[model samples]
Target: MKKANLTKIILSISACVLIGFLSSFATRSSVDTWFLTLKKPFFNPPSWLFAPIWTILYILMGYSFSIIWNNKGQSRKSKEIIKNAMMLFGIQLALNAIWSILFFGLCNPFLALIEILLLWLMIFETIKAFKKVDVYASKLLIPYLVWVSFATILNGSIWFLNS
Candidate 1:
């Protein structure tokens, strides 16, 4: 891809990130209350870690998507893979945000755990699909998958301990 094209993709990804963040704004107060009162796992990192970790992961995700977007796959198989990948990507992102809403906005750790588990599965399937198109893109998702798996455990732990 040309420099200009790369710039456009990155900017669009950033906008997506911003929009994702903003969409959860109404729940911020609840997040503050619920997050602070939570009985976190012993392995849980400080709250400050989330922003940076997610920012980097989002950048990697954007880069991965760009690879798919840049592909000129006139082949039927390639087209199907891209279409499925994009759809799964969107679903996983929605799940990610919905987990936050379930946990913080509704103050329901149990439901959040369920949502996150599904999110993890979606992400794994997405990576599997992306691999057929670009190996590097699949590799880029490893950290995200690992982090969410860890998070799933952490979410369960919190719910168990708090209950």
Candidate 2:
């Protein structure tokens, strides 16, 4: 790859990873105090599992974004299509970060549950938009989608059990 393209990929991956670490601030602060006391569902995985899983997910998310970003548009219409897809990608990424704040920072499972649903929808929309740019990029997000789907269930279950 060209140096410029390599730089873009690295920057994209770094940005995504940074966002993930920023989001983790909430979880890190609350995990020992607030989160430890929560009434998690029986299916909830061990605490140590989240960090590595999220790391992998964020890496995949960045790679997926880069694939779409690197797609060369042949026309104005195509460029517009790419632009819209990137917008969706940004929105979903922001939503992903907000979920950590809502659930861990604010310590509100109910509110988190609501926000997670929105996050889930945004992810689905992002996948659809990315599909228009690159099918493989869209495919890359399936694990993220599946993980978030499972998280939504877990969050809802936690809300139900605790409330």
Candidate 3:
């Protein structure tokens, strides 16, 4: 790849990692104190699994977004479509971070459940939009969507058990 393209990819990954890092602050503060005390569902994965899973997911998200960003749409309408798709991606990314703040920072799993539903929808919309520009990019997001689907269930269960 060209130097400029490589730079863009690096930046995109950095953006995703930065978001994850910031969100983790909220999580780290609570994991040992608040989170460990909660009554998690039977299906809840072991505590050790979350960090690595999220790390991989975030990397995938970054690569998927970079694919969309680097797509060469020729027409004005196509460019507009790409812009809209990217905007959706941004919204979902924000929601992802907000979830950690809501659940861990504020210690509110109920509110986090509601926010996660919105995040799931936004991710779905992002996938659809990405497919219009680049099928591969859209495919790349499927794991993220699936993971979020599972997480939504996990969040709901946590709320149900705790509340």
Candidate 4:
């Protein structure tokens, strides 16, 4: 791929992630207020940890997309496959952002738990689809999946304890 095109891919990937993150900015300041009000599980990690974990996971996801896009095996068939996989990836990403909106933006931990459940399932399917196209793509999603699984459990615990 041309340098410019590569830059576009990187930038595009960055934009998508940033938008997802930025969408929650309005709620971030209120996060503590809402979170502190809730009854949390004893195992909940410090809030400081999530950003780093998500940053690494997002970078991995970007690299995974780059690998698929740059693959020589990407013919019409592969193109369709990659595109579909990327779409699913995008959907799960958007679903992730929705959890932030529901949890922090709307301050609804109960609804957020349900949203994270769907996001977790979608991420699982995304990993499977990604595996079919590129093993690296699937591998790249491991941390994302792991972190989300943790979050899902945390979300449930928070909701249950607080309610």
Provide the TM-score for each candidate, comma-separated. Answer: 0.89, 0.95, 0.96, 0.87
Alpha-carbon runs more than 4 Å astray in model 1: 1-4, 23-27
- Give one digit per residue, the lDDT tens place, for model 3 in 1-163: 2112676778888899899999999998899999999999889998899889888888888888888888767999999998999999999999999999999999999999999999999999999999998888888899999999999999999999999
TM value for model 1: 0.89
Model 4 bad stretches (over 4 Å): 1-5, 72-75
By TM-score, how accurate is candidate 4?
Answer: 0.87
Ranking by TM-score: 3, 2, 1, 4
Query: How do the residues 95-128 of candidate 1 rate in per-residue lDDT, one tens digit apiece?
Result: 8778777877788889989999999999999899
- In TM-score terms, candidate 2 sits at 0.95
lDDT of each: 0.79, 0.90, 0.91, 0.78
Q: Write the per-residue lDDT of candidate 2 for residues 115-160, one digit (tens) a residue.
A: 9999999999999998888888898899999999999999999999
Compared with the true structure, model 3 gives a TM-score of: 0.96
Backbone clash count, each prediction separately = 0, 0, 0, 0
Worst 10 residues of 4 by lDDT: 1-10
Better of 2 and 3 by lDDT: 3
Q: Which candidate number maximizes lDDT? A: 3
How far does residue 48 in candidate 3 sit from its true spot (Å)?
A: 1.4
